[model samples]
Target: MKVSLFITCLTDLYAPTVGMAVVKTLEHFGCQVDFPADQTCCGQPAFNNGYPEHARTLAQRMIEVFKKADYIVTPSGSCCAMIRDHYPHLFADDEVHQPEALEFVGRTYEFIEFLTKILKVDLTPYRLPEPVDFTYHYTCHLRGLEMTGDPCIGLLRQIGNCRFVPLEKAEQCCGFGGTFATKYPDISGAIVRDKVQCGNRTRAQVMIVNDGGCAMNIGGAGHRYGSTFAVRHAAEIIATALEGGKDNARR
Candidate 1:
């Protein structure tokens, strides 16, 4: 399968390794992955901030960038959700780009969803080390996307002796709604405080989530507040497995 990777803005800027990990994971499963350089921000920042015109500009550019791919895959569920679930609404009234926009959305899939549902790739061959206790923070966009949750949990379950710690309110937002964090710092900080508290209560060594924005918010705050737990993306965890990390060590 020809898979085009949409390295969302956050990954391209703050976490390029996540993009590399995505490529490695796909190739590990025998799929050919390509990165389209023309791809830019998925425009969720502006869209969520109530600037549809600017969001549409970037969204249209993204659509054109990956129009030729058989499948479009991304690591961030929030960005993927923007393209898949929200882009169509952005072009609903326009005939010129409506069909193209819809097609672009149709071809896009979150990484785990594509791997487990469409590709059905077996991950056991990656050789993950003895696992440690960790919790998963399912981002709002992922749950809202309505993709199957089993792929993530099922893959993690394959790790040797890895404990999947469930957060008290796993589905609740960490309150890092992109621009929301900047606009309302107090509320955002309060939300992240609770999220970190939840993870700390679990006594887990790390907190894993799929959204880059949330990871930055939670991880940054966790570091600032001297929270011992680390934050990482699911792809990073999978990369650790492939690299043979013991106790989920850094690769």
Candidate 2:
């Protein structure tokens, strides 16, 4: 299938490797992945900060940039949620853009959601060179997507030589609500501290978080709190497993 990569602002600026990992993983599953260089921020930060006009400007750019893509995939659940959940509402009053906005939402899928729901790609054939114990952090934006179960955890379980430890209060927010972390540092700090403590309790080698914002917030908190596990994106783990396994599937 043809897939276009929507490298979200956080992933583009702070975690480019996560974007690369996503491409690697998708290509391994026989997808023809391409990056649209014209794509920019999904206006999530501005939109969340109550700047609708500025956010709409950026959203319009995104709508036009990836209009031809058969599937728009991104590593960050937060960005996917922004496009899928908020874009329509942004253009609700504009009859000209509302239909385009809805089409954009329908074509976009967060990375894990694409893998488990659309591709249904079997990860059983992949194995890691060494066993890794990992737990998942369910980013708040994922709730916006209305996903039913823990698809990331399920996919992680499919990999050989990896242990899936249940994170205590797995669905709890990591306290990074885009500008929410900056505007309310004390509240955000307190919540992230609790999130790191929960991950530490898991005793896992790494905590898998698909959203860049949450990962940054949790990683910062983890550093201050001296968290036991490293923070990593799911795509990174999957890419590593695909590369290490004997049945390497990339084209």
Per-residue lDDT of candidate 2, residues 1-251 (tens digit):
99999998789999999999999999989999999999989998899888999999999999899999999999998899988888988999999988988998999999999999999988888888878999999888888897758788899888888799989988788899888899899999989999999999999999999999999999999998899999999999999998876564321
How many pairs collide in each candidate, listed in order? 0, 0
Best by lDDT: 2
The lDDT per prediction is: 0.83, 0.91
Looking at candidate 2, the ten consecutive residues that score lowest on lDDT are 242-251
Alpha-carbon TM-score of each model against the true structure: 0.92, 0.96
lDDT computed for candidate 2: 0.91
TM-score of 2: 0.96
- Residues 29-76 of candidate 1: C-alpha lDDT, one tens digit per residue: 778899888788989989988899999999988988898899999999
